[model samples]
Target chain A: MLFLKRYLPLVICGFTGVVFGIQYYVPHKASEDLLTFINDWMIIIFGFSMILALASLFHVHYQKIRRRQSGWGFSLIVFIAIIVTVIIGIISQGETVDEKGLTSFGWIYTNMLVPLSGTMFSILAFFIASAAFRAFRARTLDAFLLLFAAIIIMFGRVPAGEYLWSKIWGAEFPLQMGDITEWIMGVLNMAARRGILLGVALGAIATSLKIIFGIERAYLGEKE
Target chain B: MRSIFHLLIFLLIEGQAFSQELTPPKELKAFDAPYDSGNVLYLTWKGMPYDSEKVDYIVYISESEEGPFFEIGRFKSNTHFKADKNWPAWAWKRTTEYHYFEISSFIKEGKEIPLENGKTYFLKLLVTDGIKQVKSNVVSAFPKGNLFNLLKLNNLIYMIIFSVIILWFIARAKKRELFLRKIPALEAIEEAIGRSTEMGRPIYFLTGRLGMSSVSTIASTIILGEVAKKVATYGTEIKVPHTDPIVMSVCQEITKQAYISAGRPDAYREDSNFFITEDQFSYTAAVDGLMVREKPAACFYMGYYYAESLLLSEVGASIGAIQIAGTDAEHQLPFFVTTCDYTLIGEELYAASAYLSKNPVLMGTLRGQDVGKGFLMGAVFIGTGLATLGTITGAMQIVSFVLDWFKGF
Candidate 1:
């Protein structure tokens, strides 16, 4: 049990990491075959872990309902939702879950998940307005610059900004609002983004090194 | 009988057309393909003639140079053939032994025959016009691996340099003192915890809608540990809702450990860190509801987020919460920057946890990363100067060479 809990995971991680790391340099048939086999093994392990996750979820909800705790009604609703969906899904499919086929599973997914996801996404518009109101305040020089940039970008995205600019400075005016916005987004924004991406990439590489060397073991939980 | 007589007449005319003068492909050669197993034989011939449409070229393989040969495929007038796919097991048996191949041209009506199993052979080419057939000279070459791949030599050198630099910095950091610039957001963690403790409101930390395997999520979890320790010390409640069960488990463990280390194990609650549904929108909705109801004083959004970044941060701001957000998700950065009081852009999220915890391993890795960034900045400066000079002086050869070298990466 001790070995399984501690050394086995470390051994597996080290072995797989080394093998896959070296696999990149070797474009041989054996390396390709091993990659395929390991990928399949990963899929199987992921499936088992998913089952464990479901069990944990069910256990948590069951405890909440049994204790009749705060929001116990919501827990009952969750149980009902799961049960109805599962039963309908099983009955519609007879056994298998065919994603493309017009079964109850597909209907439930398309009707429920897709719209709910879109609604959550659409809710972002209101949030954006609220957030913009807070962020666009001209309190300092940096804040004023951010506010100016935000206004220019907002104006440039719509046709009214270009129209207003042309009316004020004539049609022959250089650098319309749209042009300024494009330059800001394309050049200045892109440059800053690239710098951030570079730093992030370096951090990721360093973290990977830490993991490979067993220097970072926080994910293994509390140090015994 | 009348139909058969008409078919005979048609065949006689076709036979006459097939017997017309047509030249054979020249400069026939066969060699093993480079950077591949010995199974593949690459064959090439001279260009097609004007009358190539009237003839069909067939590829044949045999074990022996004797009479028997098997047709592998037929083409109109291809000058080269990659004989890798659709070969027999014996042909691609992963051996250094060579096999024979023949390129033959015949009338379109020529029947393809299978070869008999036998001994060793070589390559041959046969050209036939309905009645007569001519055989060309044979050629063969064995496939083998080279000791080194010269193409990827530059890449190998770069990898070694990078590895050495990273290792050297890590070793130095483990032994020697290291300096890291202070991140304001990380420093504000204590302030956020203190505010929640004063207001008697819970602290809500979102680990993003990602699993534990994600590096960003790992950073968030580490940050969570630090925050939990402070909260435990202050006896302030903290709620962590996770979309992934594995992450929830890890967060629960980290929170428990934090409380234990803070000597507030009695105040720690297991129910505080719990799993929400795996569904992204459902998880978001649940968290939104929790925010509206509980109205946490301090909200920390950490890890990789998608569309939900704005929704969560905006809601937190609406409740007048002191929101601190950190993520490597560049697209969502603008949203977090707009909503949160303090936002850690990209790698700052990773560095924040390291800075807060003062974990030697993390600090060393972070310092190594800074070293890498410094090296890159220097290289970029040099490269830019060279490019600008090359462009201005109309001498781009050096610049191009350097660019090609970098492109090898």
Candidate 2:
């Protein structure tokens, strides 16, 4: 049991990680075929894991119902939703919509899922404004700089800013807010973004090497 | 007077020569495409003038050079130069004078036929400007497989060197203590759990909306192990809602192990790491609803995130939760910084695991990463100096060598 749980997994992980890592540099047909084969297996595994997910879901909601917990009605709703969706999916042969019109699965998905998702997405607009209000309070020098930049960007994106600039300084003004905005976004922002990207890449590499070498097993539920 | 006479004479001769015919496609050759399986051929030709907009080159392919060649492709002249190819700067000279084309398939009567390995194919190039067509001699090429992609040699070499550096550091760290600089977010974990425990409210930990395949998600799960262990020790409820089932399963195991390691095996709850729906915003909506109702004391968002980052973090902030977020998503960093109490920027997300655990081997990897970053920083500084000097001084040739080398790196 220990071997199956611990050593075997490590060996498999180490072997596959190193193999795939090397496979990236090999342009041969065999290596490419191996990648395709492994990807197919992953897809198969993902399909099988859905059973475990559904079982967990059923267990959680079932317990809530059995105990007659608060908001047990919601748990009951979840159970009904899952069952209805699954039945519709299986009966429709996994097709959401047919040639003629909406199938049973399509009716549920188009009616229930899409609008709910849209509502959630629309909430991001309000969140962004609220977050921006917090961020642009100008409590510190950094906040002030952020506020300044944000104001400039907001102005530069519109034609009114250009018109005001031309009115303030003649048409032949050497500097423009548009140019400054471009410099900030293209030069300053790009340089900082590139630095962060490099750090992210290096970090990813370090973590991957740790995993492949078996130095990182915390993800395996191991202590170190 | 003599120069004008010479110019007229030259114009008379050159004009007649130009009016007679267009330049024929010359030195047409086909070879196996490099850095690929033996399934394509790269064809190169010369002799067409760069400004010839009206003229185009037609490429034909066949098994035999004698007859029955079919059209593979056709394109305008002065384009598809070798200099514009996608190969790395250091890999080839990329002769700008020659036009090149990659032909992997031929369409005959609307049916596509692919070139195969172990097959010798003949190709011919013809230059035409609506009226005149000039044909080049046939060239044959045999497609053969390559064992390695030399184009990615620099990438492979860097990987190997970085791996050796990390391993060396790991070995050294085993003998001596390695110093890991402070990341404030790692310190905040214990406090957040304590607060949650005191309030008797659960701490929400999300492993972002990514699967097990992503490195960010993997890092998040590693950090999840640490966070869950702390929660278990504090006897605080830790709820992990997952969008990916595989990740949820992994987190469940991690949570269980953390409980066992904390000597609170009975506190482990299987439903703590539950799967929400996979649809992105739907999952966000669900998590938002849950947070509003339950009002968790602390919220930990770790892993890759999308636009929904602000939505989740804002809700946490509204609930007065100590929201600690970590992700490598640079675009969303600003939102996290604005909303969350603590945000781990980019690489710090990965380093949090090592910092919190203080395991020598893992810490060594962090040290190695820092050193690697230092090296990159030095290279970027020198490269930028040289490039700026070249641009300002108009001595581009002096910097081209350095710039191209840096570009390859």
Compared with the true structure, all predictions reach lDDT values of 0.73, 0.88
Tens-digit lDDT string for candidate 2 (B1-409):
9999999999998986676467667778899988787898999876455236788888999988786899878888878889777466566556678888998888767889888887999999888888878888889997877888887787787788889999999999999998777788889999999999999999999999888999999999999999999998999999988888899899999999999999999989889998777789978987888899899999999999998899999999999999999999999998999999999999999998789888887888888998899889888899889989999999866677556644552
Which predicted model would earn the best TM-score?
Answer: 2
Off by over 4 Å in 1: A1-8, A67-69, A94-101, A165-178, B1-156, B265-268, B386-398
- Residue B214 lDDT, candidate 1, scale 0-100: 83
Worst 10 residues of 1 chain B by lDDT: B90-99
lDDT, residue B20, candidate 2: 47
Summarize candidate 1's per-residue lDDT along B1-409 as a digit string, tens digits.
Answer: 9999999999998886665545555677776544332234555565443224445556655555663565565544332233323232222222212223433321223764322212223555565544555555665544433323334555666666766677787677778778888888888889999999999999999998887668899889888888998999999999998888778878888898889989999999977887778777788888888888788999999999998888888888889899999999999999988888888999998776568767665687776777778877887788788889999998775465564444432
Q: List the residue pairs that clash in candidate 2.
A: none
Best by lDDT: 2
Every model's TM-score: 0.76, 0.93
Output the lDDT of residue A82, model 1. Answer: 85
* Candidate DockQ scores, in order: 0.34, 0.80
